[model samples]
Every structure is written in structure tokens, then in C-alpha cells.
Target: MIEIKNLSKAYKKRKVLHHIDATISNPGIYAVLGPNGSGKTTLMKICMGLVLPDEGDVYIYRESVRASIQYRRMVSYLPQIARFPDNLKVKELLQLTEHLRGKAQRKEMLMELLDLDPYMDQLFRNLSGGTQQKVNLVTCLMYDVPLYLLDEPTAALDPVTQIRLKEFIQHERERGKMVVLTTHVPHLVQAIADEIFFLLYGDIYFHGSVEQLIGAYQANDVEEAIARLLMYEQEKVKI
Candidate 1:
């Protein structure tokens, strides 16, 4: 469903992604993992056409995203940080999104699933961080798209909400949709990810299944292996 070719991006003197080449053509959840500044968010933004790549091209459904953006119709993205107009109420914002998308989305269903109906009339800024995140999730997941790119979907979510998000992701995969996400939550990744891309220093350094990752790093679990990989990358940079 998606292909990235020779993708590279930099800001002034710093590079955020280097020749990132990957494909997400099949249905499954792929997790992108790394320490701070690994370019996970930048990678997703480039795919979404929100950020222009300094080099290379991203193709969605065989159409080049850099040249045309019609392919974005197949994607649903949940950004790491959501910024909404403070004056608008939660329900109003959702209505606006549905109007703009011109689709009969499952907004009401998502609101109920997230338990956001209670805050429907509250202004965006009035919601607490976790509540606001839930609102964002409702809007983002309301539509059924072929590809989903979620950056830290579990962030600011309560434990129960986190589990709900995981179940939702799994549901999408079962429906034959592609799900790509970046997260620091190890247990979440362990539960849902069919594949893992360990990004380090702006590049994908490791790609494998969860069990393969633990075996490769000789760590007792997913979190420990992730820690080991990050440390290995940092040390490699210094040498």
C-alpha cells in the first residue's frame, strides 16, 4: 500500500532521516522504535505529505506522494501532538472534521468507545491531557482507511484506554488494513506488532519479529532489547 524509496530528510545541518527505504504493502502492524530524535515522526509526516523530503520519493497506492497527494485519501494519521482550536467544543470539532472529509465516518461510535461523549460540549482547551488525547483518537480512528500511521497513539492515555487502542489497532489489521505506529511502550508493541523496525540515528537498523528481536539482542524481553539496541546505537556513534 505504501513504498518509500531513498528517502532522506535534513534540517539545516542535522539529518533526521537517511535513505529510508521500506514498504508497507500487506496488512499488519509495524512498529517503529528508537530513542529521542530517531526521526520516527518525521518519517510518518513525509509519508503523509505534511513534510517534504529532501530526497527520494514516497508512493501510496502506486502514486508518488511527492508529485501528487490524491493517494492520501487512503491514509488516516494520528499525530503525536494534536492542536485544536481552543474555542471549539469537542463535538463541534468532530463535526467539522466529518464535514471536511466528506465521509460518513463512525464519529459517534468512536466517541462512545473512547468514553468521550461526556465531554462532547466541552471546549477543546478545557479537556485534560488524557481526555484531549482521547478526543484526538476518536477523530483520527473514526474513518476506515487502507493505511493508518499513528504516532504515539497510547501517549497520555490511561491503562484501560491504552488496551482499548491496542484492540482497535488489532481490529484494523484483521480487516486487512496496514497499521504503522511509533511507540515507546514495549508491552503494547509485544501484544500487537507483527513486525518491528528499530530505527536508530535516522535509519532503520533492525527489522524483525518480536521474538527475533529478543533473540538478536539476547535480552530477556522486548523492553530490555529495545534498551540494548538504543545503547548499541549510541555507542556506535561515538566510536
Candidate 2:
């Protein structure tokens, strides 16, 4: 459903993504794994048309992101950080989002699932970090979109909320929605990702299923596999 061709991006002298090419043709949960500054967020932003690629193009359902804004209608993005007007109440913010987008198909359900109903009348600035993240999730997931781009979705979430979010993501996949997320959590990827794209030094270092990643590194689990991959890359740099 999505194709990225020869995509490259640089910030002044620092290159974030280097001629990257990848495609997602099926409906499932895909995880983008990478260390900090490895361009995971940049890649997703490019796909969402929030950032322009210097060298190539991203096409959603056959329409180039560079060619049109309409392609974004199919995408719902949850940014790594959530920011809103401090004075607005939680419910008011949700209402504003609904006003901008169309009516959310599952807002109330998400709010309930995230335990956000109690804080509905509270001001945005008054919510705790975890609660704020829950609000962010409710806004993003409430829309019934074909594609979801979630960046560090479980940032401030507690274990219970994190598990709920995972369940929601899995449910989305079951409904034939394509869910793409970037996370440093190994267990989260192991639990929900049908496929993974591992980014290192601005390129796709590995792309495969969770079992394939562990098998490729000869590791017992996802955490060890990732550690091995990082150590191997560091040794290569030293060589």
C-alpha cells in the first residue's frame, strides 16, 4: 500500500536517511527499529508528507506524496511528542481535533479504553505525562484510517496502558489496517510486529520477521539480537 523509492534526506552536513527504499504491500503491524538519530522519525515524516525527501518520493496507494495532499487522508499519525494548548481541556482538544478532521469513529471508546474519561474536564496542562500521552493516543486512534504511523507510542505509558495500546494495535491489524510504529522496545516488537525494518547508520540494516532477526544474529531473543547487531556495526566502524 506504500512504496518509498530512493529516498534520501540530510540536515545540513548530517545525513539522516540515505537512498532508502522500502515497501509495505500488506495490512499488518510493521515496526521500524533504530537507535537515536538513525532517521526513523524522519522516514515516517517523509511518508506522511510532513517532511520532504531530498532525492526521492513516497507513494501511498499509487499517489506520490510529493504530488498531492490527498494521500494524507488515508494516514493517521501520532507524533513522538504530544503538544496542545495548555488552557484547553482534554475534551475540548479532542473536540477541536474532531472539528478539523471529520467526526471520530471511535473517540469515546478510545477515551474509555485509555481511562481518559475521568480527565476529560481537566485542562491539558494539568494532566500528568502519562495521562497526556493517553490523550495523544485517543486522538490519533479514534480516527478509522487505513494507515497508522505511530512514533514512540508508549513513551510515558504505564504497563497496563501499554498493554492496552498493543491490543488496540493488534485489533487494527485484524481489521486489515496497516499499522507502522517506531519503538526501542524489543518486547513490543516481538509481541505485535509481523515484520520489522531495522535501521542503522541511515540505511535499512535488516528487514524481516522477528524470528528471522533473532536467527540472523544467532540470538535467543529480540533483545540479544539487537545488541548483537549494534555491537557488530560498532566493530565494523572500528575496523
Candidate 3:
């Protein structure tokens, strides 16, 4: 449902993404992996039209992202950072989000699953960091959209909540929804990601199934493979 071709982006003299190309035509979770300053976030932003590309274009459902915004209706995005008016209560924030989206939300079950009932009347800023991340997940995942873009979704979530989030991801995949996530959690990638895209130095270093990632790097595990990829980059600089 998403196609990126020859995408490139830069800030002044520094490039963040370089001629990246990929397509997602199936329903499953795709994990974008990269170290800091590797352009993972920039790639996601270009897809959402939050940042314009210096070259190439992103297409969603046969429409070019640079041309129109109507394609966003089919997308649900959860940013890396969740920010809101600190004075707003949890329920108020949710209500405002629904009103802005103009769509019926499936929030009740998610709220219960996340154990957010006690915080309904509490100010958003008063909640703990983990609680805020849970609320963030509820606000994004409770929507019925063709594509879900989550950046650092498991951040600040406890072990229990992380398990719950994985369950939700699996449910969506079975229901024919596409989830593209950016996470450094190795276990999360091995658990839910059907495809993994590793970004290195503004380019796609690797894009394949999780098994392929392991096999290509010849590592016994995901962590080892990731380390190898990082070291590979360092060696390139020394060359």
C-alpha cells in the first residue's frame, strides 16, 4: 500500500536519507532499524509528508504524497514523542483527538487493556511516563486504519504493557492492517516484524526477513547481527 522510490533528503550540507526505495504491499509489521543519526525518523516523516523530500516521491494507494493529502485518511501515526496540553485530562485529550479525526474510535477496549480507567480524570502531565506511553498507544492503535506508523512504540512501557502491545500488533496483522514501526528492541523485532529494514549512513543497509538479517550477518542471534552491522559501518569509515 506504500511505495517509496529514490527518496532522498538532507538538511543544509548533511544528508539524512539517500535514494531509498521500498514498497509495502502486504499486511504485516515492518520494523525499521538504525542507530542514531541513521535517518530512520526522516524516512518515516517523508512518508507522512511531515518533511518534504529533496528527490523522488512517496506514493500511497497509487497517489503521490507530494501532490495530495487525502491519502492520510488511511494512515494512523504515533510519533516518537507524545506531547499534549499538560492541563488536559486523559479523557479530554481522547475526546479532542476523536473530534479532530472526525471518526468513531474503538477506545473502550484499549483503555481497559491498558488499565487507564483510574487515570481518566487525571491530568495528562500528572501520569507517569509509562502511563503516558500506554495512553499514546491507545490513542493510535484504537483507530481502524489501513496503515499504522509507530515510532519507538515500546518506549517507557513496562514488560506487561509491552506484551499487551505485541498482542495488539498481532491482532491487527491478522485483521489485514499494515504496521510499520521503528524500534531498537531486538526481541520486539524477532517477535512481530515480518520484515526488517536496517538503515546505515543515510542508505538502506539491509532490507529482508528477520531470518535473512541473521543469516546475512552470519550471527547466532539478532543482537549479534545488529552489532556486526554497526561494526561493519565503523570498518567502512576506517577504510
Candidate 4:
């Protein structure tokens, strides 16, 4: 469904992504894992056409991102930070998003699931961080699109809401939609990700299933596996 070919990006002297190549051909949750500055967000932004690649191209359903923007209509994106107008009410933000995008088929359902009705009349800036994140989620997930790009989706979410979001993501996968998310939470990745793309310093360090990741690192769990990978790199640097 998506193809990233020899994708590279740099900002002045520092490179954020390097000749990255990956393909998503099936419908499932794919986790893009990495430490800070590992180019996780950069990759997603490039895919969304929000940022242009320094080299190479991304294709969605065979259409190059550099070619046209019509392919974005097939994607639903949740940015890491919620930056809506401060004065707008929750309801207004939803209305505005729907106005910009087409009508959201699952807006009402997601609002109920996220318990957003109580906050509908509240100003976006007045809402709590978690509430704002919930609102962000509703705006993104309400669209019934073929692909979802979520960046740090559970950042400020409560445990209950996180569980609900995971369930919703699973449901989307069950319905044959591709969900790509970048998260630092190991357990969340273990629970929902069918495939993992582990990024380290602008390169894909590992790409496999959760089981394969742990097994490759000879670790019992995701957390330990990640630690081991970092330790391995550290040891390499000292060599």
C-alpha cells in the first residue's frame, strides 16, 4: 500500500534520514520505533507530504508523493502535538476539520468512545493535556481512511483511554486498514504491532515481528530487546 524508496533527508549539516527503504503491502499495525532524533517523525512527515525528501520518493498506492497531493486523501494523520486554535471549542474544531476534509463517517462514534461530548463546548486551550490529545485523536480517527499515520498517539493519554485507542486501532486493522504509529512505549508495540521498523540514528536497525526482535537480541521482552540493541551499538562505538 505504501513504498518508500531510497528516501533521504537532511537539515543543513545534520541528516535525519538516510537511504531508507520500506514497503507496506498488507493491512496491519506497523510500529516505527526509535530514540529521539531517530527520524521517526521525519519519515512520517515525508510520507504525508508535509516535508519534502532531500532525495528519493514515497509512493502511496503507486502515486509518488512528489507527483501529486491527491494521495493524501487516502491517509488520516495524527500529529504528535495538538496545535488547534486556542479560542475554538472542541465542537468547532471538529466541525472545521470535517469542513476541510470530507464528512467524517465515524466522528460521533469516536466522540462517544473518547468521552468527548462533555468537552465539546469547552475551549481547546482550556482543556487538559490528555483531553486535548483525546480531541486530537477524534479528529484523526474519525476519518475512515485506508491508511493512518499516528505520531506518539498515546503521549498524554490515561491508561483507560490508551486501552480504548488500542482497541480502536485493532478494529481498524481488522477492517483491513493500515495503521503506522511511532511510539516509545514498548508494551504498546508488543500488543498491537504486527511489524516493527526499529530506527537508530537515521537508519533502520531492525525490521521484523515483535518475537523476531526479542529473539534477535536474545531478550525476553521488548524493553530488554531495545536496551540490548542500544548496548550493542554502544559497544561498537568503543571498538
**TM-score to true structure, per model:** 0.97, 0.98, 0.97, 0.98
Residue-by-residue lDDT tens digits, candidate 2, 168-216: 9999999999999999899999999999999987899999999999999
Q: Which candidate gets the maximum lDDT versus the true structure?
A: 4
Ranking 2 against 3 by lDDT, winner:
2
- What's the CA error at residue 70 for candidate 3, in Å? 1.0
TM-score, candidate 2, is: 0.98
Looking at model 1, the pairs that clash are: 1-25
Preferred candidate (lDDT higher): 1 or 2: 2
Instruction: Compose the digit string of candidate 3's lDDT tens values, residues 1-239.
Output: 99999999999989989899999999999999999888887888888889999999999887898998999999988888898887999999999989888654689989998899999999999999999988888888778889999999999998998898899889999999999999989989988899999998788889999999999999987888999988987898999
lDDT by residue for model 4 over 147-174, one digit each (tens)? 9999999999999999999999999999
lDDT of 2: 0.93
- Over 4 Å off, model 4: none
- Per residue, candidate 1 scores C-alpha lDDT tens digits across 60-162 of 8999988987887888899999988879999899889888886747877788778998998999999999999998888789988888899999999999888
The per-model lDDT (C-alpha) reads 0.89, 0.93, 0.90, 0.94
